[model samples]
Target: MTRYILTTCLCLFAALAQAQMRWNQAYQQYINQYKDLAIEQMLKYNIPASITLAQGLFESRAGLSVLATKGNNHFGIKCHGWQGRAVYHDDDARNECFRAYRNAYESYEDHSRFLAGGQRYRKLFSLKVTDYKGWAHGLRAAGYATNPQYAKKLIEIIQLYKLHEFDKARKYDKFFARRSKDIAGKGGVLHQVFEFNNNYYVKARRGDTFRTIAAEVGISYRSLAKYNERNRKDILEEGEIIYLKKKRTKAPKSYKGRLHYVKPGESMYSIAQLYGIRLANLYKMNGLSPDYQIRVGDGLRLR
Candidate 1:
């Protein structure tokens, strides 16, 4: 009798696990259908497509939740400033006020813009899409959800579903040339040279790890490690100034204004001259674009 009981428990457990796996598989299918829309929104808003998709999947339970069925709110975004339509649904317990969208696309667009327009998320925009870890942490810091493990859950979903690849930029012109016709038109190409103090520093985004910045800028990680006064394994802080070459660095000058998009074959020297600003001033205001080799469509601060 004991053996039979144990066998029955094992079977039940296996069945439950299988059911859970099926649910996850179904959720992935839902995400796959909307992957392109997510990527498009990410490109326009700088939010990682993975985060957007994960939030949608989790909150809507792969579109099986009542909120999604009735209201089309995949992320459970509240009606804090909502002026459109509102719906109440049982979430934590009592019915909660949620924003209602006309369709799923509207929800995605609102979520992306919500993060982008918020001042708290402004710092996160400086990060690259691949730096989902930082963005995950940032979201938590910005109070996206109440759960303590929110970032971990989102990261797990992204990895399990291979959503991070959406952020990968097409560096090869030929590859992007074909992609441009299918996707968004050809990506802009602009090269920038970031010159700082006596030495030059590579322009870096928030998502750039010290190791990645070092590798891209052709400096030893150890050298960068020593210069930044950080441990070799330490993640880099956004806007933490460091020199590409080993030398004493000076405080960068700050320019107040909006960033201008760099065009193809544009140099920092020419950009500065065109804006009627000193090259050094322009370099200090911006970090990564001064390197003289900038990609087209990259934003440069003009003010």
Candidate 2:
């Protein structure tokens, strides 16, 4: 009898574990489906993608709620003077009216405008787009939801999914993804990223262009150009080092007190690129003017 009971308990535990796994998969699928919309809304409306996603996930139960599935309401936004199609759902009261949309995109867009246009959320706008915590707490304080734990719930969701990455879509640049070989789906091109001077960079392979590198590394094309101090349309050589970050003014400490001897076929720009230092700073360090001529065998201080 004891053995039979233990077996039954083990079976029930296995079922419960599988149910949890399914729920996690559902949440991840929900994020995958709506992440782009959330990011788009953030860029257009100056809202944090993390906050938008958390709200959608929580309010819509990962887009599985009746309002979301049937009425296309991912945010649980109620019809407070909403001049559009509507759905009624139980909330603070029975069958409370909620705004409905033709599609999830429309719902996401409306959620952005709703927050952007509301006076109560004006203070949220003042917070940095990367400050998901502030936005989460502020939403509750501004009465965006009646639940006292709304902010906590949103924060938990954001952390669980690492959704804050989308908040600083441009600046953080995938949190400067350390030696991230995981750029497989970002672009088909394969290039090894390296870390130096507390920054990241990648080498330009044969046939690599700024656009291609940017696409592969999940960086903006223009940003990669600026980092490399090159024009957007400039061609990348087979072995050129393209810094993902703005090159430092001086070489790293390890190269201190060392001097770079101008080698044949090398220019000031090439030397700076080699050391991952700013060209302007390199010139400044060696007391060389902007148009100073560098000849072969001339010693230039790297630091």
User: For model 2, which pairs clash?
Assistant: none
Residues 53-164 of candidate 1 have per-residue lDDT tens digits of 7888887877667767777777888888889988897766688889987666677778888888888789999998889888988998888888998888787777877778
Error of 1 at 155 (Å): 0.8
Candidate 2 is scored at a TM of 0.50
Q: Cα lDDT of model 2 overall? A: 0.81
Best prediction by lDDT: 2
Q: Which lDDT values do the candidates have, in the order given?
A: 0.66, 0.81
RMSD of each: 19.9, 11.7
Q: Write the per-residue lDDT of candidate 2 for residues 211-276, one digit (tens) a residue.
A: 998876668999999998999999999889999878998888988888889989999999998888
| Each prediction's TM-score versus the true structure | 0.49, 0.50
